[model samples]
Target: MKAVEYRLPKEFDKSFIVFKEQGLYFPCPWHYHPEYEFVLVNKSSGRRMVGDHIGTFLEGDLVLMGPSLPHVWVNDQKYFEKENTETADAVVVHFLKDFLGENFFNLPESEPLKKILNLSNRGLVILGHTRYQITKIMNAMPRQNGLKRLSSLFEIFDILANSSEYELLASPSYMENTRDMYSDRFSKITEYILRNFHRDITLKEVADQANMATTTFCNFFKEHFRMTFVEYLNAIRIGHVCKLLADRDKTIISVAYECGFNNLANFNRQFKRLKDMTPKEYRKALEAEPMIA
Candidate 1:
């Protein structure tokens, strides 16, 4: 997708911005900015797209993204319903590499921080105990001002710099050229796929969305997603299927059809291809050893 560039609102007295943002759901677009961002998803469940990667996120999702790294958090459809009452909230911090001073982080004392900041170009997901510790600090940032706020930020960075409990999002190829030439063309197609993946989506349909010939679109889809269009769509459908399997109340066959699978045989085949297990086996494992988080 082509990420729209945004200039974050600024305050006269502060070189960075930090606060608690709350709303019915995240209203941000698929966008990027010059400033580095640290976001702690204090409350919400959604799918998060970072660069060319897409995955699910739940409460306590903490990530740090470097400048110009495209990203967005789209809440589940329920949050957007007019009658829904749940709120989405997060602690968002934005700053520039030179926010303090161009040479401040270059000092010998800041080597670790500089190293991690450089790695943030790929986007980092905070995990383990470090995630919880930083969550507390981020939750407290909005109430402080002046030097106190800056101090808390530095503390968070120090922890992140020393920690290995984190995973990098986005592929090396995507990060090498953050702005893909065909990005603008892909945006419309990505939106169409996400919205319609629950149903049968044909090659001609998606090709029309991209305004390209079917053959050309086939090559383009493979290049962009490193998978055939059908493989990509099935991956999306399977991702949602895994989530539904967590709730055993629904029958496996019903869950398969609800997620757009037309036949039980094909659904079972695809499910195993992606998850390395059948839907029933996946559910049985979940029941035996449920995730604590």
Candidate 2:
């Protein structure tokens, strides 16, 4: 997919940009920049694309991405409805590798920090205690400026440097071959899928969205997504279905239909293939736990 370039606003007084974002829809689009990014989503639920990785993102999501890594978080359909008042809120930090100094990370004391920055080129999701700690710091970032804010940035870095509670998002292959796909129609195709995935979607329809033949588009999608188009769509649907299953008021059949499954039998089969459990069993498991998906 061709990713768009995003220009982060300049702030000469600050060593890096740390700010809060709040809007009916996230101001972000599918784009990239030259600086590394730290994003913490305090309020929002949506689909996030990091390089070639596409997955569900919910409130409290935290991700770190290296320079020029293409990514975006597309808000769910509910955020787009005229009647919905909920806003997408996040704290984002952007800084260059040498924002501290040209050779700061090269110092012996900064080995761990250097290591994580290398890993972030593929994008990383900060998780567990690390996520919680970082979330607290991100919330206080805007309220504190100058040296205090800079120190908080270091505090987050130290947590990341020592902790193993994280996962890489994009594949090594995607990072290595980004030059070849820099100008692509993949983003256009994904936007179409996000808008229509609540109902049936076909390969032919997606191919048309990309203005490519079905066969050609399928091959390209598999290379970037690590799965076929149908596999990707079902994965997205099942993600939402899991959330719906948490609601005891909705029958499993209704949940499946709402998530785009027309055939009950097919839905059951697909659900099992992905989650290793049938829809009814999955519902029962969640109902017992009493937690949101």
Candidate 3:
């Protein structure tokens, strides 16, 4: 399995760091960081894996990740093709809990800011009009320095603290175990599963990959991921199928087979169980969209 990589900003001495990059994939492997992160996807689209949550992400998506959360932005392969004209871009801000000094949150003036950081503990996805407002703040980060940068970060947090237009992505149970020591093991398992999910994977295969007994692997996975091994595999398969469905010319039967289902009946059943809609309905909905945004 490939090792998970995390990019920490260099040049900034403060607990909070902000940086931007162009034409570069973040290359974040299913790794976690001690500091909280706010990532704005200005121009990229791919599968977004945060904790146990998986979804299709696009440009203008803004995500807030809490401390010790595992995540990665796997850029689509098509974007990296030689003939492709567009490149990936992003703005990321990372900060520790004590970035504002030890007593800052306790101060009366910092009440709102404290609330915002607290809300971020569960991880939030800012959407609708709120995303644009935050993007403006991020757009200005590159020009600021010293006290100005710190002040701007505080202002951004204020907006997040007061906004009600965000959604929490991780479950409360997962949030409670943020400090659990099994993250590395979980990362190994997930990385293996993600890499080999397209093939026929069995319990022994995954368990051996984790270097644990089948029983132990099952118990550990359920305890941390909140789902059984089969459940997780099916979820990944369904997510892949959705991506294929977006291509109008693809046939439902072909997509089902390509996604690793042994038979169409099994694929249809699993798709309906996970998505609550048939493949035809799912494809039709995508066609109805005027645009992906």
Off by over 4 Å in 3: 1-7, 12-15, 177-293
lDDT of 1 by residue, 79-110 (tens): 87899999999999999978989888878888
Q: Sum up the clashes in candidate 2.
A: 1
TM-score of 2: 0.61
Give the range where candidate 2 is weakest over 10 consecutive residues by summed lDDT.
173-182
- Residue 200, candidate 2: alpha-carbon lDDT: 80
Over the stretch 35-144, how does candidate 2's per-residue lDDT look in tens digits? Answer: 98999999989877676455679999999998988788878879889999899999999998788899898788898787788778878998899999999998999989
What tens digits encode model 3's per-residue C-alpha lDDT throughout 1-293?
Answer: 11244658657456578888677455555567778899898897886656544556899989998777666677776775788887788898988767767777678777766655555665678898888899999979978888888888877878876787887664332353333233676667777876777789999989998889999989988876567988878877876787677676788888877778887788999888765668887676444322121
Better of 1 and 3 by TM-score: 1
For model 2, what is the alpha-carbon lDDT of residue 282? 63
If both were scored by lDDT, which would come out higher, candidate 1 or candidate 3?
Answer: 1
Model 3 TM-score?
A: 0.58
lDDT of 2: 0.79
The C-alpha local distance difference test score for the whole of candidate 3 amounts to 0.72
Q: What is the C-alpha lDDT of each candidate?
A: 0.79, 0.79, 0.72
